[model samples]
Target: MSVERDILAKNDREANANRREFSRLGIFALNLVSSPGSGKTTLLVETIGRLGGELPITVIEGDQQTSNDAERIRATGAKAVQVNTGKGCHLDAHMVGHALERLAPAADSVVMIENVGNLVCPSAFDLGEAHKVVVLSVTEGEDKPLKYPDMFAAADLMILNKCDLLPHLAFDAALVEANARRVNPAIEILRLSATTGEGMDAWLAWIRGGAVEARRRRAAAAPRAQGCACAEAAAKA
Candidate 1:
């Protein structure tokens, strides 16, 4: 058991190192995870439309088959790479590491990784993202967090999409937020209707916030990881 735990811890540590390297390369990356039809692609397209030219943005779209999502992202004026995971259920850090070579975003670019639409598997894998944004829709029911706690717990940001049609559905928005909070106390929630553009600005602001924060953290940790033990400790601290 101790050996297994050590292996798992080593994987997570390596994933964290990859994330630091991505930051050091001047890339602001985000992993977008969600179930099918949860509007992850729509939100990403909208994000690209708003963020394009201002920042060089790229996307990696993962699916079991077809490059459909990557096609949509390409239409939004962002470079996109399609990764058909075959039998794999998640996009691990190693996968992202390979995809980054194909993506090749500019020095000050943002990379959005749209993971395969699985609430369970994707959350279990670390894709070396600065933040994991879980896209949950009102149509998916409010008990989703209870059904798939790992995804909610792993997410740094939660996007509740499709709020425009709330009156026609039986979905409980308050219950969803409550349950998500129970699983992830520190999650930043953004309720938005991607179709109607209702809450998009807030979500965009949160994305900007994550990018800025990631860059600042990377800059602050650069010089300390040189030689001394105290310096290494200070770099991480």
Candidate 2:
């Protein structure tokens, strides 16, 4: 117990540092987590397609092996860095920090970190994201949130993916949302089909809002040195 606590404590410290760096760079970082085959990669691809040109987007793909995900992200014309975790089940703050160094995302850019597919392990690790978005596919059933309460609880947003297949599947989307809210009442939910582009507008808008807020916070945090642009702007406001 003591060893586990110590390890998590160290991770928390590193996560705080990563958070500070993200704030300084005005990056809206998102950690996307889910079980394997939950369509996280597909969702990311669709998201990038919709917003890649509008926003300077970068991705850090985490997987046990292979850089396939990163390659796919790069094909979208966005910069991506792959962090092969090998035997590790999740990407910790230290690993994400290293990936950030390699990514070098532009200021005010949005960085999406696609975590290794695992509902259990990834929820326990903080990768210094502005929010943790969990993708749950309808094919996985409506009881997933109850089965993996920790993951749902840790997420700021729950994305019900593959909704276009709901007609073929018996999955109840409402039940899934209820279960997610049971674990995390404050969690915002979005239903979307990455394949058909349905419901993507809301998702893109949410990301835009977060990115705007990140830049706003960064500007507000800038030092008020005499004649500094930020300070001058603030004084004018």
Candidate 3:
């Protein structure tokens, strides 16, 4: 128990530092987490297609092996860095920080980190993101939220992906949402099908809103940053 706590404490410290750097660079980072077949990559591809040119967006793909996800992201004309975690089940703050260094995402841009597909380990690790967006497909059991309460609780937004499959599946969308709310009442949920482009407008709108807010924050901090630089120069002189 002590060892686990210590490891998490260290990870949190690094995550805080990463957050500071991200804020300084005006990057709106989001950690996307879910089970292996939750369609996270497809959602990202669609998202990039819709907002890539309008807003500078970059991606950091984490997987046990292969750069397939990163390749898909790149195909949409977005800069992406693939982090092969090997045997690791999650992407920690340190890994994301290094990926950020390599990607050097544009200022006031959105940095989406697609974490290794797992509903468990990723919940315990913070990747210095503005929010953790968890994707849950309708094909998965409706009781997943109850089973993986920690993941739902940690997520800021719950994306119900593959909604197009709802017609063929016996999954109960309402029950799933209720379960998710039971675990995380404050979590905002969005239903969308990346393949069919259904409910995509809302998702795109949310992304746009986040990006706008990030830019606003950066603009608000610019004057203070400039003043600090001027003061430092005067002191040196």
Per-model TM values vs. the true structure = 0.87, 0.92, 0.95
After superposition, the stretches of candidate 3 with alpha carbons farther than 4 Å from their true spots are 1-6, 234-237
lDDT, candidate 1, at 117: 91
lDDT of 3: 0.94
- Cα distance off (Å), candidate 3, residue 87: 0.9
In the range 155-231, model 2's lDDT, one tens digit per residue, is: 99999999999999989899999999999999999999999999999999999999999999888877643349867
Query: Could you give me the TM-score of model 1 versus the true structure?
Result: 0.87
Top candidate, metric TM-score: 3
lDDT of 1 at 148: 98
Better of 1 and 2 by lDDT: 2
lDDT of candidate 1 at residue 153, scale 0 to 100: 99
- Candidate 2 regions exceeding 4 Å error are 1-6, 223-237
Candidate 1 minimal-lDDT segment of 10 residues = 1-10
Q: How far in Å is the alpha carbon of 17 misplaced in model 1?
A: 4.2
Question: In candidate 3, how many Å is residue 209 off?
Answer: 1.2
